[model samples]
Target: MKSAILAVVLAMPPQAILAEDVPTTVAHPRPVISEIVTADPARARRFPGVIEGENVATLGFLTGGRLASVPVEAGDQVMQGDTLATLDQVTLQQDLASARAALETVQAKATLAAQQFARAETLRARGVASDAMLDNARANRDAIAAKVKNARASLTRAEDAAQYSTLTAPTEGIVLSVLAEPGATVSAGSAVIKLAAPTGREAVIDVPEAFAALLPPDAVFSLRRDKNDTAATTARLSVIEPVAETSLGTRRLRLALDNPPKDYRIGSLVEASYATVSAPLMTLPRVAIAIAEGPNGPGVWRIEGADRRAHFIAVTLGNTIGDRVVIRDGIAVGDEIVTRGAHALTENQNVGDRLE
Candidate 1:
């Protein structure tokens, strides 16, 4: 009976062997993707930029002195001739007092000299004084007269110096900065305050010299706050710097804002958009194109054949407008182009199974 049981077990297949021989279905999940068709359209070019005032002036004292008091602070609105600060006028006052005293002394001396000259002229008329004595008296009077004039000039100059102790605003604008504080000693012409006229704000942007030829004279531009999604302020191109800013590898372009915001301050960052060119061209989302090695060189992916399989298509790229790029050639309107999931696609790949 044992021998018969052994023979039956050999005739039947082992359980492990049967399990390994079983067949099963392997399922692959298709990737989800979104796509758009190539269409000919015009798009604008958005460039990063910054806001700036048309007129920015640094306020400072004409004479060097200790800053006695600063009445205005940063962000203070000021008008032309408004007192911004005052310097210690102790020395200036003393100089003016001395000048006045000197003028008085010179005037008194001039009066005495005039009386002596008259006396000398009378003596000469009576033949008691010689011509030389009369001439001496007249010369002394003239010398004293010149001294009085010099003293008066000195007084005027001293008074003018005293007036310089007060720092005044140059234009109607807001104070952007206050460099000197009370008791701070500043040198002559040292910047003590920064003024900016927001009413004359301009949008300044830097563009590469290579692309400068594409820009037009008096082109319209749009400017908005950096990282902002709000509507931009319209401006017109007014200046193109003759020399390129080598440090930035770009040329400066200035635009005059039509109506600036009341709260728009100077030195605020902004983004600028310039319409370089407008032409009928096929544009597609940046993601729709996939770079791959082809028989010639770099190529993009496109749906080909009724099966809509991904195929490598060679194309020449043009300028990029926002998130879309212009395909110079190789793509046409109504052409179904993959926008997403194109990075993983290869030639002959079945896009029908691709997920959107």
Candidate 2:
């Protein structure tokens, strides 16, 4: 009876619960981890931009007139004082001629008055004329002199008006647009031509308000068409507008391109980068971060023991630098951090095939 009781007890499933937990000795693949170290950080900011000339102007007529001849067309290169257009000058010419004739007549009268005054003075000196008579001659001479001055001034004004009938380039530049054609009437101060100075080009970019504050006054820039090629040229920060544009909520920044490309055209779209801030930072592969259940909440992968098993460590992450993130407090330098296969790991999970 005693032997049978011992056998029954032995057969009753060993009296201990065998928990089927994941084997700690199972050689699962370990994740590759890179040590976090302090290094120079790259400071970068991107902004949209367009190429533009330094000087741009809209040329206009100074006087109202019917356009008779437009000597230059759009895209025409002009020099200072080059004729751009001509107005109907027949009326102006007639007025100038009438003014000159009137001026000539006034000058003849003034000359006769001067001669009469001289004769009256000579007669008074010889006691042949009364003082009152001499005074009358002097007054007549002064009146004619005033008439002559007025006529000459009128002639000068008429000449200037005639000159205004012709349009000339104010400065050397490329003609970008022609508003009025031949036979079209243009009013004074109406834009007739668009001129762009060819000295150098400037790029205007709108920087986001967040990045604008971090940008340095003298930050360097590289301008390029694509990422594969080297930058065609470099630019320096020239202007930082004080006011932010209401529509874009961004600040305006101007960069002066040194030796701008020949293919650069006004209004051409461009990509620009502004180095805002830089500092030493720790970096790791993006795969090192993992979200797993922990005592508090979700956590990341961290090695704890000599076996390099993964530990679900809670981390407070900071700014991301490229593929890596800044760890605020969770992990430290010399800590073995799993970089890959982190998602498949669990707390206290044994791992094998450890990688450097």
Candidate 3:
């Protein structure tokens, strides 16, 4: 019975291997690690701009004359209908006076002709004056009446000329420049002053034609004094120049500011940026992107928190801005990504933390 038992035991499968007796190998590698930086998908990029008035007006005289007075200068604010400048009224006044005298003379002649016609009519009725005499008196009266009407029209024109000698502001605005000095002779309709409306302040920026074409139709914007300034004001894309500037290869964009800061003034330099974010995205260092694809798609070598091993995680990529790329998916915030030497890493490989 003992021999039979021994034979059964010897034929039995070798005793089960002990786990403690087995040896395992572990790998440790030092790799660059970058903490995920959470931010708005649409990052603001600044472009230079200038603050200016939306409506810029060039004011001048309706008629030619020497400028006797110019009451406003650059930076002076004026209301609508305020006198801006005036021409020497001496010539206009003299012309008006002469017209008035001419009118008076024509009126006297008409009065005398009317009296003579009345006398002629009575004499003809009494059979003393001939029909020829009545006819001549009537002709003289009609001729004088026509002269009086012409004289009255001349007087009215003279009065208008005198009134036009003074130039007034068409609207409330600030004077931007004084093109003509006092006592300077200017031609009719020549620009004398440059005025800008108080309202309608806008930020003027030059955008490359290519860049402008890429912008969305409803893209929003904001303005700031500088890149470091935290304060921002809303802005609307008001107008875009139909034609591009050949020399600069850029198009003019006018952005109307909303509730702008008090320091914003005409000619002030500003920075403008897009306010709308198309999508929420995660940003990662450009070096972290691997050329190879994973089972899902484009991926990164993500380090495991507990194991300190690199694992390939598929990700959807987006636009790259500078040295960073927009991550559309797969990686969560706070995930440690291999920024450098990611191309050399393999799936589930041990990694060392190196933060820079």
> How would you encode candidate 1's per-residue C-alpha lDDT over 111-154 as one tens digit per residue?
99999999999999999999999999999999999999999998
Q: How many clashes (backbone atoms < 3 Å, residues ≥3 apart in a chain or on different chains) does model 2 have?
A: 0
- Regions of model 3 farther than 4 Å from truth: 1-45, 97-154, 187-189, 279-356
Query: Model 1 misses residue 278 by how many Å?
Result: 1.9
Point out the higher-scoring one by TM-score: 1 or 2. 1
Give the deviation of candidate 1 from the true structure as CA RMSD.
13.1
TM-score of every candidate: 0.53, 0.49, 0.51
Q: Write the per-residue lDDT of candidate 2 for residues 1-356, one digit (tens) a residue.
A: 99999998778763243434444464554545535344423345456688877888987777776788888876677999999888788867887899999999999999999999999999999999999989999999999999999999989877877878888888988777788888888877898888888676888888765455545567778776556647556888888889998787788888998888876666667777754334323455667777654455534677767776777777776656456566666666567677767787767877664554
**Ten contiguous residues minimizing lDDT sum, candidate 1:** 34-43
Worst 10 residues of 2 by lDDT: 34-43
Candidate 1 deviant stretches above 4 angstroms:
1-49, 55-67, 79-82, 160-165, 168-172, 177-193, 208-214, 227-233, 241-251, 258-264, 279-356
| TM-score top scorer | 1
Native-to-model Cα distance after best TM-score fit, residue 298 in candidate 3, in Å: 21
